[model samples]
Structure formats: C-alpha cells, structure tokens
Target: MAFERNTQETYYESIIRQGYSRRDFMKFSTYIAAYMGLETSAIGQVAKSLETTHRIPVIWEHYQECTCCSESFIRSDHPIVADIILDKISLDYTLTLMAASGHQAEAAKHATMEKYKGEYILCVEGSVPMGDDGNYCCIAGRSAKDLLIEAAEGAKAIIAWGSCACNGCVQAAYPNPTQATPIDKIIKNKPIIKVPGCPPIGEVMAGIIVHLITFDRLPELDNIGRPKAFYAKRVHDSCYRRPYYDAGLFAETFDDQNAKEGYCLYKVGCKGPMTYNSCGTIRWNNGVSFPIQSGHGCIGCSEEDFWDNGPFYERMTGLAGFGIESSADTIGKVAAGVLAGGLAAHAIAANISKRKELRDSIRTARENEKKFES
Candidate 1:
C-alpha cells in the first residue's frame, strides 16, 4: 500500500481552490470559533490556523451500529462545514460516504495509514461486536475487531463519534445478544475523545473537528471523555422551562393544559436534570429546536447506558442518596418544599438586616442630641 507524496494543501487553500471566497472562509472560521466556545479574540486565530495548517488525513471506520452519525454530519447547518471541514480533509476511507468499495476502499485506507503513520486521525463511528469471537459484524470478510485494530495502530488520535462508538449505545443495552463493546474498552493505550449522543448535533461534530484543526490537539475532556465545551452543562441548566421547575410548575401528563403552557416536564420523565449535552443551547437542525422545544422531554441519549436506565417515559424519582422517596405523585411536593425553604431563608436574612439598620439610626440620633446640649 504505497501512496505518492503530493504537496498537502492547507484547508483554506483547498476551499479557495474550490471557489469559496476569502470572506466566506473567514466567516466560516468565526462561526466555528463561536461554536467551539473560543474567545472573541480567537476568531482570527482560527482563521489563521485554517489558512496555514495542512488538512488532517482521516480514516473513518464503521461497524455494528446505524449510520445516523454520517447522516447528521452531512446535514450540518452550513454547507461549508461539509464542504470545507469534511470534504477538504484527506478523508481516505469511510464505508458509508466513499464511493469506492471492496478492494479499492481497503486499499485507500491502508495507503493513508502507511503514508501518514502517526499523523492521521482515526474516526470510529460504531461499536464492535465481540460476541461469538466477533462474528456479529464483519467487513470485507474480516471481523470489525480486526479492522479496528489494524487501522488504529498508527493513528495519532482516535475519535469515538456518537454513543454507539462511545458507550456501545443500544446494541450493548440490557440483555445484549451480540456483546457489543465500546472503542475505548477494545483499544487501550490511546486517548479517545468520545462524542456521545444517539447522533450528536451536527454543529457539535464540526466544532470538535475545528478545535482539533486549530489547536493541533484534542479539546479538554471531562471525566467521561466528552469535550468539556459541549458537555460541561446539563441540558436542564439552560433549558427554557427551568423557570417552571424552580417555581414548582410542571406538566403532569402530555397534551394537558400544563404542557400547552410549556411547564416543566419532570413528572412525565424529562431527563434534562441528569443529562449533560449542548442540545438546549447549540440545538439541532441549525439551532431551530431540540426535543424539549418540540414538546418532548429529554430521553438522556447522551449519557452512557441510557437505554437500560429505565423506561423513557417514566420519571426516575427513586434515585438513591437523595433521602427522599420519588414518585410521580410526590414530585410537586418536593419542588414546593425546596421553593418554600429558599423563600424562608431570604425573609429571615432580610429581617436581620432591617433590625441592624434601625439600631444604627437610633444610636446616631442620640449622639447628635447629646453633642447639641453640650
């Protein structure tokens, strides 16, 4: 698998050669920087990096899961993301997107791996099935495990895209017949950046790539390996209906007047409070609306083992360590108690401040009267 070494073109050069204007390129850079949670001053830095840095060679592998991650990537809000970020990169191999198949596809992947060695990025899209000696999923007459190990050997970095690759997704859910396993567990000794979601938001996917391209390093990750910029905040923290939750207003059931009024959906099984994702902010379909905005509670798809957590429509109130029995009937009572306690503490503090102010006023008046008599 020998590849001719051609001059590697920078991302900006590729875009310009493809007929995108300079303005368009910089605008795309600014958009990427914002989504990557970079400071305002970093817009120029992003543009400069894209202008000079050679496009990263990528080998995208797919295995035992749906192709929704590819679907989401293609449907990014701006066509430039697909055109510049994905297309401009030397994407040597991807089972779903590459037109070449069979021997041609296998050749391309090997060529990139051999040529780039430890410089290329390995993007894995699904989990590997190890049940029955990895018989569950095979590609080109070889098990997925064999292919993944071969591809990952010389890669500089690995990206586990979507929940399937990150946490084995639903394939490894309760009573999993295929014994699907996540990439991190299979491949040790490599730092994997996990982008966990049923199919992560398109912009979020692009943001991760742009960060890698600009910084020449992986973005900061939380304990779970998800990028901190996107997974740092819970969906509930920024949810529009958070006010309702704080005020003890909630929808008991779907299609009720409370729901129509956009009250909190905690009782009907919203997982926003427990799930960390950028859905409430970055949103899907170009920031239009997410699941909650569409009148459905969060299913916590981003979290690991979400499928086995419980029924999707059932509120999980019997959580351990909260010292409270949880049920649909008792949710309102809990919310009310929290609100009442907060109000009482505020009132007590205000009374103490008011008494101190009056005491000071009387003491000052008496001192002034004594000084005048003297």
Candidate 2:
C-alpha cells in the first residue's frame, strides 16, 4: 500500500504530448468556463488552473450498474474533456479503459491508490451491494464493498458519478435484492459530490471536473451533494411550454394536438416541476434537445429513486400547495392585466400633466391682460 503521487504536469507539457496547441488548450478552457456558467472574467481563472495543475489522478471504480457513466465521459463535446478525462485519463489506471488486464490492472489500481493516497480523486459509477457480504459485485476476485473501502481510504474526494453511485439508482430501487448502497452511505470522511442522473448529461459531468480543476475545489453543492449550478432550478422553470402551464393549458395525452402545439406536459406525468437539473436549459446532446423538448414528458431521471417513483407516464394524482395550482394557473392572465393597467395609468398621468399646462397658460394670459389695462 505504499506509493508516490504522479508529478504535476504543465498544460504546455500535456499539450505537446497530446499533439494539441497551447491555443487549443486555452480554447478548451474558455469553452469549459462558459459551459460551467462562469462569468466572462472567470475564463482567466479556469485557464490558469488547467495550465498549472497537474492532471488529477483518478481511480474510477465500477460496481453493480452499466458503464453509461464512462460512456458519457468519453463523448463530451469539448476535445479536452474527452481526451483528458477518458482516453488520457485512463493512461494512468481505470478498470474499464485501462489496457492492462487481470493482475496488471489490479496492480495499477493499487499503485495509484498508494502513490496518490489522499490526493487522487475517486470516481465511483455504481452502487455497492451490501447484502450477502457484497457478493453481488465482484471485481478481479475482490468483493465490491472491500474494493470501495480500500479505494476510498486514501482518496482526496469522491464523485458519485451517476444515480447509481449517488442514490443507489435502479439497483437499489423498491424491493432492492442486493441492498445496493450509495457512496456517502459507506465512505464517511471524504467530501462526496453526487451528480445524480440515470446517466448524467455529458457536459454536466465535464463541467463538474472543470470546476474542480479551475476552482481547486468542489463547486457549491446543494443539500443532496449535487452541484447547485446545474441542479438549482427545476426543469419546469425553464421549459419553453411553461407559459402554457401558467395559463392552465396542458397536454392530456402524448399525441394530442396540445402536445403538438407545445402545451405543458404536466398532465402526462412530466416531473419537470419537481425535478431539478440543467436539462431544460442545457438540453442534452450538445444542446439540441431534451426529453421535454422532444415532445416527451420529463421522467425526472436525475432525482433519487426515480425508477421507483412510479410509472413514468402516470399523471400526478392531485395538485399540492395552495397557490401553485390555483394562483399559478392564472399567471399569464395576471401578468397581462398588470401590463395593461400600467399603460393606462401612464396615459392618465400624461393627460393630467397636459391639462395642467394649458390651464397655467390661460391664467398667465389673463394676468398679462389685467396688467396692461391698469
């Protein structure tokens, strides 16, 4: 378990090695800054951090789930994100992408864990099954629980990469057979950031990494440990069809005309109002479209136990909260009325001002006439 951390490499060093220009690296940094919703002034900070900080050593562990998280990482739009995060990322040690197999791979993980102990980042992609002493997941002859504990022991921080690792995902859904467990449930000490989604959006995943690289710290996390920048607003808050929702218009069925007309999907079990994610604003697949934009209701995949939340197509049984259903229903009408009233008030004020001016002129003329007579 004894090892040494990898030397920090300069951005120029990585650029030369990767056959990319220094300009290319800077451009990537700028894109990253923008994607992370950073201010224009923050481009410098992002570039500076990437240029100086050595590539963070990462131990990405996979457990009782599909490899979608890894899949998403490799497909990030930014060239730097894909290259630096997955391909070159594993040039160090990741079980899925690492070329070394069997004992060699195991040895590599151990070496990185030891050498970079308490310095490397741990990226866990799946849930650990605690039942049967963690028999549900075994890697290279080691139980998943044992592997997680061993890997987490020397980590600087942990990133729960998908709903699986963050909230036990589907594997831990209702009547969970294996008793899947999230990272925070087992690893107590490290600062764990949960990027919860069935499979989180690629840029969101990359943005987190960039924020960490740039800020030299985790981005601000909400109560659930998910980054607030991406998970702060409900998907409904930014949906293009939100005005329709506020106007009491809704799509009763997926194929209804209202649906075709881009009416609100709340009637079709759209969880947009309840779920929080950047999907509506940042839309998946290079900002092309998200579920709601593609004529489908938001399944709310980014939330905890979403799979167990019930049928994705079932409408919410009843409206909750006082004004949300009633008052919000008339929002569009209310806003319009207020605007009209404001215009009328301005006109009345203007007319009064003009009348006052005319009266003052007449009085002044009369006073002049009297003075001349005297």
Which candidate comes out best when scored by TM-score? 1
Give the TM-score comparing model 2 with the true structure, all chains together: 0.81
Can you tell me which runs of candidate 1 are displaced by over 4 Å? 1-7, 317-374
Model 2 CA lDDT for position 336: 91
- Candidate 2 wrongly placed segments (more than 4 Å): 1-6, 318-374
**Candidate 2 residue-pair clash tally:** 3
Best by lDDT: 1
Give candidate 1's error at residue 355 in angstroms: 60
Model 2: clashing residue pairs?
Answer: 3-115, 4-115, 118-154
lDDT of 1 at 243: 97
- How would you encode candidate 1's per-residue C-alpha lDDT over 1-374 as one tens digit per residue? 21332327898888898888999898898888899999989999999999889888889999987989988987888778887677545577888777678898888888898888999999999999999999899999999999999989999999999999999899999788999999999999777999999999888999998899899999999998999999999999989999999999999899899999999998899999999999999999989999999999999998998987766777864543344446544776889999999999999888887988878998999899989954
Tens digits of per-residue lDDT, candidate 2, 1-374, equal 11232346754466558888877887887887887999889999988877777777778899987988888777777777777655664235666787777787788788887777888888999999999999989998889999999999998889999889988988898789999999899999999999988788899999998787778799999988999989999999989889999999999998889988999999889999989898888787778888988988998888887876656886643323434344433665688999999999999988787998878998999899989954
